[model samples]
Target chain A: MLSKKQARAFFLGGTLVTFLIFIGLTIFSLSKDVDQTNHENITEAVVRGKDLWDHNNCMGCHTLLGEGGYYAPELTKVIDRRGRPYIKAVLMSKVPWQPNGRKMVAYGFTNEQAEDLIAFFDWIDDIDLNGFDRVVSPLAKDKTN
Target chain B: MTLYKGKRRTTTALVLSMGLFFAALLYLPGMLPFDSQVTDSFFRWWVVHLWVEGVWELIMGGILSFLLIKLTGVDREVIEKWLYVIVGLTFLSGVLGTGHHYYYIGVNKIWLIVGGIFSALEPLAFLAMALFAVNMYRKGEKKHPNKLALYWTLGAAIVSFVGAGLLGFAHTLPQTNLYTHGTLVTAMHGHLAFWGAYAMIVLAIISYAMPNMTGRKLYDTGRGRMAFWFSNVGMVGMTVAFGVAGVAQVYMERIMKIEFMKVQEMMEIHFYILIICATLFTTGILMYIADFIKHGQPTDEALIKE
Candidate 1:
C-alpha cells in the first residue's frame, strides 16, 4: 500500500540502519571482552614471528585468531599446551613430527626462526581467550557457565 | 514498467535482508557473556549461520523470481508459484539447518543430533532452485533477446546447486564438519556458495536491467560475453584451487598430523593460483562496469514502451 518512492526510501534506510547497528553492537561487545593486557612483552621478536607466520602462510594448516585452516590444532594457545622448548625442538627437526596419528609437516626452521615463532606464540599466550574449551553445560556438576 | 520492477524487487530484497539482520542483532546481546569462550562461540555462529544460510536465501529468491518472470516471458503467476515453493523449501530447512553450526559450539549435546539431521535436508532447497530455474527457461517458448542475462540467470541457478547444494553437502554432515569445519575445506564451499547463489543473481539482475534502464541494447557485444565467461571461469578456477588445497591440507595437517605451519608452507602454491584467478575475476568485473558506464544516464524518455 506504500508508494514506490516511500517504499524505496524505507527499504534503503532500514537496511542501512540495521547493518550499522549490528556491526556497531558486535564491535562494542567484542571490545569489552578483549584482554590483551600482555602488550608489554610484544617485542620486535614477536612481531617478526608474526611476520614469519604470515610469510610462510602457517594459517593454511593451522588456526590462529580463529580464522585459519583447522587441519592442525589452534595455535592461539599452542605455547601453553606445548612448552617453548618442545615447540622449538619440533620446529628445528625436519622429520614429520607426529602430534597424533597424522605426521606433522616439517618446515626446517633454524633455532632463531623457531625462537621467534615461539616468542610470538608466547606473546599470544598472555592474552585471555576466555577458556575456549571449558565445560559449561548445566549437566556438569561444576558448570563454568 | 522497468522502474516498477527495480523498485519492487529492490525494496523486497532490502526488507528481507534487514529483517534477518535485525533478528540476529536481537539475538547477539545475550551471547555477550565473554567469560566463557564457549558461550561466545555459541552465539557467534547464530549471526553467521542464520544470515548466509537463512534470510539471505529469501533475498536471492526474490531477485531470482523477478528475473525469471522478466527474462523467461513466463506468466507472472507461474513464476510466483515456483517462487512460493522455493521460499517454502528454503525456510523449512534453512531455519533449522542453522543447527549445523551448533555442533561442538559448546551448546547442549542435543545439537549433535538436531544439527546433523536438519542440515542434511538443506541441500533440497538449493536443488529445487536449480530445477526451478532450468524448467522455467525450457518452458519459455519465446527467446529473450538478452542472451547475457539468460546465461547469468541459468548460471546462477545451476552453479548454486553445485556450490551451495552438492559441494556444501560434500562436508556438511556433523561427522565431516567435525574435521573440516574451520579448514580450507569450508573456504571452498563458502567461496562457491557466495559466488553462485548471491553474486550470480546480482549480476543477472544487472545484466537484465541495465540495457532496459538506459535505453541501450548492448547484450550481443563480445565484451559482455567475455565478462560473463571470464568471471564464471575465474570463479570456478578459484573454487577448484581452494578445493585442491583444502583436501591436501586436511590430509597433511589433520590426518598426517604435520605441524600446521609446515603443511601451510607446502600449500603456498595453491594460494598463488588463487591470487591469479582472483585477478582474472576482477578484470571481468571491470569490463562489466565499463559497459555499464557506456550505457549513459537513464532518462524518462529512455523507458521502453510495450
Candidate 2:
C-alpha cells in the first residue's frame, strides 16, 4: 500500500520529469534543422491573410492544417485543389457562397484582400505535412494532372 | 492575509493556478506569426492539448477528491492519496501523449512512436479514477443522503473513462488518426469527452452544492432524476449519430476519394439526427435550470455549522 507521502512524491516527481522532457522535445522539434515549415516565405500579404482568417473566425466552419471545425472543407491544400480564381470569386462575392446547401458567410473582400488570402493559402499549400497533405482527403492533393 | 488555508484548500488553489498558467500560454502561439506553421501549431498544442490532458486533469482530481470526501464520507487521507496517484498517472502518460497531435503536423517521426504509446496509456488514469470513485462509494460507511450527487459523480467518472479514455484511444493511433484526423470523427470524440469529463463534473458539484446552500432538498424530485437520464441518453444518441456520420465520411471522402461537398450532402441525414438529440439534451438542461430556480437563492440560514 502506497503511503500518502509517497503518493505526493510520485505526483511531484512524475510531473517534473515529464514536463522537462516535453520542453526538451519542443525545443528539438522547433530547431532550425527540424523545421518543415517554409518560414522564410511569409510575406506581409500572408500575415494579413492570417489576420483575416483569425478575425473572421473562419475556423468556426473551416479547418486549417486538419485543425478546426469540420463543418467546412479543410483549407490546408486549398490553393492546389481549387484555383486562385475560384477562391477569389468565393471571397469577393457579395452574396453567401452556398455550396452543397451549406452557406459560407459573405465577406465580400476587396480584390487586394482576396489576393492576400490567396497568398496565405499558397503558402499553406507548400508546407511539408509529414504526408498528411497526401493522406488527407484526396481533394487535398493537387489536381493539376 | 492568511492565504494559506488548509492543505486541501492550498492544493486546490495551486492546481487551478496551474490550469490558469497553461491557459495564459495560449497567447504564445498568437504572438508567433503563423509563418512558422509547425512551431505555431506545436505551441498551440502546449495550450490546447496540455490544458485538457495535463493541468485540467489535476483540477479534476482535486474536485473528485473533494466530492468523494463529501459524498462518501471517505477519509480525506485515503482519498487524497489516491488523488495524488491518479494525477501522477495522468502526467506520466498525458505529457508525452501530446505527441499524438504532433504526428501529422510536420514534426519528427519520434512523435509517432512516443504519442502512440503514451496516449494509449492515458486511459489508465481515467480507469483509476473510475475505480477510485466506485471503491470509495463501497467503502463509505456514511451515505450522505444526496443520491443525485452520487449519480452525477459516478457518472462523471465512468462516462469520462468511456468518452475521454476509450474513444480517445480509438483514434489516437497514428494510422487511424491519419484517416480520421480532421473529419467529423474528431467532432464525435470532442463532444462526448468534454461533456463527460468537464461538464459532468461541474454538474455533479452543482447538484451536490445546491441543496446544502439553499436549504432545499430537491435532490429526490422526479425532474432532477429525469434531467440526469434525459441528458445522458440524448448525449449518447448524439455521439452515435456523429460516429455513424464520421465513419461514412472516412469511407467516402478519405478512402473512396469522393468529392468533399458531395459526401457532406449525403450525410445530411445524420445532422438531422444530431439536431433531434440536441433538442432532447437542451430540454434536460432547461429542466435542470428550472429546478435550480425553484431552489431559490442561498441564505445564511443554510450554512453548515462546523
Candidate 3:
C-alpha cells in the first residue's frame, strides 16, 4: 500500500543514510591508527613495480591479495613461496615461463625492473592480511612449521 | 537532453541518473596508488564490489521497471512505486554489503560481522525484483506480442535472483569466503552473476528495441527463440563446469594444502568442459548477431511513426 511519494522518500532516505555511513567507514578504516598494510615501506621501486604490474595487466592472470583472474597462481605470498631468483629468472627469461604447462607471457624484464617487481612482491608479502596470507599460500605456513 | 525533451521527468530517469553518478564515482578509488594494500584493496571494492552489487542494481531496477511497464502494459505509478522500494532495498543491503570484501583484506573485525549480516540481506532486493516482474506480468491486461522480449525480461529477473542473489549468497559469508575467496569458486559465481544480471538485461532491452526500431517483427522466429535457450543453457552448463572445478580447487588447494599448480592441473578437464560450453554460448551470440544484421539499418520510415 505504499504510495509513490513514500516509496521515493524511502529510496532517497535509504541511499543518503547508507552512502554517508559507507563514507564514514571508509574514512575510519583507512585512518593511520588502524593501518595494517605497512604503508611506510612503499619505496620508489615498489611504486614502479606496481606500475609494471598494472601496465602489463599481470592481474589478467595472477592474483595479488586474493584479487585477480584465477587463471594463475595467487601471488599474495609469492616471494615467500617462490624465491626471488626463480621469479627473477621467469621475468628475465626471453621465452614464456611454462612451469606446469600453463604459459605466462614473458616480459623479458631488465634486471632493475625485475628487482623492482621483486621489491613490490616483497612489500606485498609483508602486509597484514588478517590471516589470509596463512590461508592463501600454505608453503609459507609449511616453512614456518 | 533530447530524449527527455517533451516527456515529464519520471522515476526511471532519476534512478538511472543516480546510477550514472555512482558509475562516475567508480574512478575515485582507482586514482589512489597501491601504496597501502589495505587502503588500496579497501577502496578498490568501492569500484569492484560497489559496481556489480550496489549502484548497478539501481540501474538494473530502473531498466527492469521500464521494461515491465512497456512489456506488461503496467501502470507507471505502480511500477515506479515498486522500483523505489526495490532501489531502497538494494542500497539498504548493498552499501554495507561492501564490507564482505573487507573481511580478509586486512581491515578490522567489524567488517566480518557487518558484511555477513548485510550481504545476507542483499538477496532480498533481487527477490523483490523477480517478484515484481512476475506480479506485473500477471496484473497486466495487455500481453505485448513480443514474446521473445518478454522471455528475456522475465529471464533477467529470475536468473539474476538465482545467479546474483542465491549463488552470491552461497559464498558471500566470511567463513565460506575464507576458504573460497581467491579460488576458481569466485569465478564460478562471477560468470553466472554477470551473465544473468547485467548481460541478460542488456539483451532483453536489445530484443525489445530491435523489432520496434527496424520495423521487422522477427520475435517469432525460431532463430530468435533458439538464441535465448541455447545461450542460457550454455551459460548454465559453463557455470556448472566452473563450479565443479572451483570446488575441487578449493578442496585441494585450501583444505588439503596442495600446491596451486598441481591443483590447477588436476582441474584441467573442467576447463575443457568450459570451452565446450563456451562454444555453445558463442554460437548463440553469433546467431543473434546474424539476426541483428538481417534486421538491417533502422530506416527513417520506422522512426516516422514516433
Which has the greatest DockQ?
2
Write down the lDDT of every candidate, Cα atoms only: 0.70, 0.84, 0.86
Q: In what order do the candidates fall by DockQ, top score first?
A: 2, 3, 1
lDDT (tens digit, per residue) of candidate 1 on B1-306: 444467455433543455456565646645554333334454666667766665677678778877887778787666665655665566566655666665544344445565677678879889988998999999987688999999999999999989998898898887676666557888899888999988988989998888876887757778888998888888889999999998997778556656556777899899899999998888888888888887646756566531
TM-score of each: 0.67, 0.93, 0.95
Predicted candidate 1 versus true structure: per-residue lDDT over A1-145, tens digit per residue: 4344553454345435544553453343334343233545668887778777877888777765444665566766576556778888888888888765556777889888899899887766555433322211111112334
Reference contacts reproduced by model 1: 0.07
lDDT of 2: 0.84
Candidate 3 residue-wise lDDT at A130? 70
User: In terms of TM-score, how similar is model 2 to the real structure?
Assistant: 0.93
Using lDDT as the measure, the top candidate is 3
Q: Candidate 3, clashing residue pairs?
A: none
lDDT of 2 by residue, A1-145 (tens): 9998898899899989988988898888777797676778889998888888889999899888898888888888787777889999999999999977889999999999999999988888887777788867765554542
Which structure is stronger by TM-score: 1 or 3? 3
Question: What TM-score does each prediction get for chain A alone?
Answer: 0.72, 0.94, 0.95
RMSD of 1: 10.1
Among incorrect, acceptable, medium and high, the docking class of model 1 is: incorrect
